[model samples]
Structures are given as C-alpha cells and as structure tokens.
Target: MMKSASTASRSSAVHMAVAFIAMGGWAAFANSAHPMPGPLIAGVVQGTLSALITLFLKRMIEALSARYPGSVGTWLPPLVAVLSSLALLSSVHWLAGTPEIVRTMAVPLSVTAVYATVYNLALRRVAAGGVG
Candidate 1:
C-alpha cells in the first residue's frame, strides 16, 4: 500500500530524530574525554549534521540510483554515500574541533553506508518488478 504524505513526513521526522539523537549521543560519549563543553558542542554539531544527512539521504540515493543503471546503479550510490559521509563528517568534525573525530564518525558513517547499500538494492529490486 502507498503511504500518505503525512505518514511519509512522519517517517522522515522519526528517522531524522533517531539519527540526531543516537549518532549525536554516540559522538558525545566518544568525545567525553575531551575538555569542558567540547563534548556538548560536538554533540550538537554531529546531531545537526546527522539530521540533515538523514533528511536528504533518501532523495540523494534515489537520484543517484536513477542517474546510473545496471551494475553501476547497484553500487555507485552506496559508494558515493560512504565517500560523502567520510568527507562531510571528517571535515565538519575537524572544523568543530571534535576530539577523536574518527571515533565520533565511525558508527554513523558505517550506518549510512549500510543503509545506502540496502536502500539502493531495494530500489533496484522494485524497479525490476521484484519484491523489495
């Protein structure tokens, strides 16, 4: 069954919240060893970044998958996601002075990569007239 627009909006909101809270909390905990207020600042930065990424991620994957076809379509979106995640997370965390940047980004990046891969695959399946 098709989802209503409100349902889709709610789902997006929930995803964004989870990304913001879980990834941000993880970043904060990972950076807790740093100086005062640093962890808090990192949490905010990571949370905002995670939320924005989650918000756009689905559309980005859909566009990328459509722009390519066949095997390239299957793999390219996820690869781009991983690269984008690394670039964005590392650069933003560095600018934010997030101590242990790699640690803070690891889980979020991994999750993004996995989600991108699975989502892309599902899109392909649905496009090919198979059950996603």
Candidate 2:
C-alpha cells in the first residue's frame, strides 16, 4: 500500500520530533558532564536547530528525487543533505559561540547522518515497490 503525500509528511515530521528529543536529551546530559554554562539551554537550542535543519534537508532530498529519477537521484540527495546540513549547523554553532564547538556539532551531525542514511534507504525501498 502506498501512502499519500500528507501521510508521508506527517510520518516524517513525527520521526524528526523523536530524533530531536533523543538527540537533545543526550546532548544536554553530555554537556552537563562538562564544565559549561547553561548546558541544558544549549542542548535544547542545538537539538532544536538540528531538527529544523534535518527537516529542511529532507525537503531538499524530496525535491531532488523528483527532479532526477534513477539511482543517481536516489543516492545523491541523502549524501548532499547530510553534508550540507553538517556544514550549515557547524557554521551556525561556531557563529553562535557554542562551547565545545566540535563536540556540540558532532552530536547533531552524527544524528543527522544516521537518520538521513536510514531515511534514504527506506525511501528508495518504498519507491522500488517495497522490495528490499
């Protein structure tokens, strides 16, 4: 059974929300372990921003998939989304003066990469008629 666009979008939004909370909680806990000020707030901020970024990236992937249909289209979008999101978030973190810049960026980037990969694979499988 195929899902309508609205249904798929809703499902993606839910997944993004869950990813945001999980990643945010982990980041907050990790930051608290370190001697940083306002760890909880920082974590929340990072997580929220990261989740938004992921959402945008997913949208980009969808657009690209539509523009270029084939294996190239299927695989390239996810890779581009991951790399672009990482760069954008890292830049944002640096400009925002986030403490432990590398570590902070790492948490979200790792989350995005994992999520994007799984998301892309699932999308491809679905596009291929659910044949894994």
Candidate 3:
C-alpha cells in the first residue's frame, strides 16, 4: 500500500538519488575504456536523465492508470514507459556520444521495465478491489 504524501515524497527523493548515483556510476564504468573525459561526461549526462525520469515515473504511472481503465490501464502505462525510456535513453546516449550505448542503457531500461510492470500490477490489483 502507498503511504502518506510526505512519506512518498521522501521515498521518491531517495529513489531518485540512488538512481542517479547507481546508473551514472554504471554508465561511467561501462565506458571507462574510452578516452579520458568521455566516461565523466557520459556519467553526468546519464545521471541527470535518470534522475529526471525517476522523479516523473511515479506520477506518469498514476496518471496513466487513472486516464485509461481496465485492460488498457493494465498494460498501456508499462508499455509506454518502456518505449519512452528506450527512445529517450537511446537518443540521449547517442547524442552524448556515450561509449557502449547499449551497455550504458541496459540496466536502466531493465529497471524501468520491471518497475513499470510491478507498479502496473499493483495498480491493477488495487483497482480490482484488492489490497493495494
């Protein structure tokens, strides 16, 4: 079940921070074999994007759930999130010239997919009159 708004805000902040550090670190490490400064630039670029996405993801899901009901609600949000993540991550990484683009994007994409799936399921259950 979800908590109070205050609690949710704190949790979201923590999650965003962790995502920024972890995903950025992973990107940097993944691209470490490249020339100097490349890894650093990639890390900053990816970290910023990851944090922004993390911040918005919950709200996106909630809005999507409310906007589209029933069967469509169950799947559309996750599918949208995954596709959007793919496009954003890939495009940004490409623009940033991030080395090993696929590798840099892998973990974040997987995480987004998993989070979207699990969150959508939870929303579905709650909508179906089950415990949230």
Instruction: Give TM-scores for every candidate, taking all chains together and pairing residue i with residue i.
Output: 0.90, 0.70, 0.89
**What are the lDDT figures for the candidates, one per model?**
0.90, 0.71, 0.89
State candidate 1's TM-score.
0.90
List the candidate 3 regions with Cα displacement exceeding 4 Å.
Answer: 1-9
Clash totals in order: 0, 0, 0
Worst 10 contiguous positions by lDDT, candidate 3: 1-10
lDDT of 3: 0.89
Best by lDDT: 1
* lDDT leaderboard ranking: 1, 3, 2
In model 1, the runs with Cα more than 4 Å from the true position are 1-10
lDDT tens string, model 2, 48-125?
876778568777766776677688876787788777977776677666666666676676777667767677777777
What lDDT does candidate 2 reach at residue 57? 72
The CA-based lDDT of model 1 is what? 0.90
- Which residue pairs collide, candidate 3? none
**RMSD from true fold, candidate 1:** 2.9
Candidate 3's residue-wise lDDT over 15-123, tens digit each?
7888899999999998999997989988988888899999988789988988898789989999999999999999999998888899889988999999998998898
Instruction: Return the clash pairs for model 2, or none.
Output: none
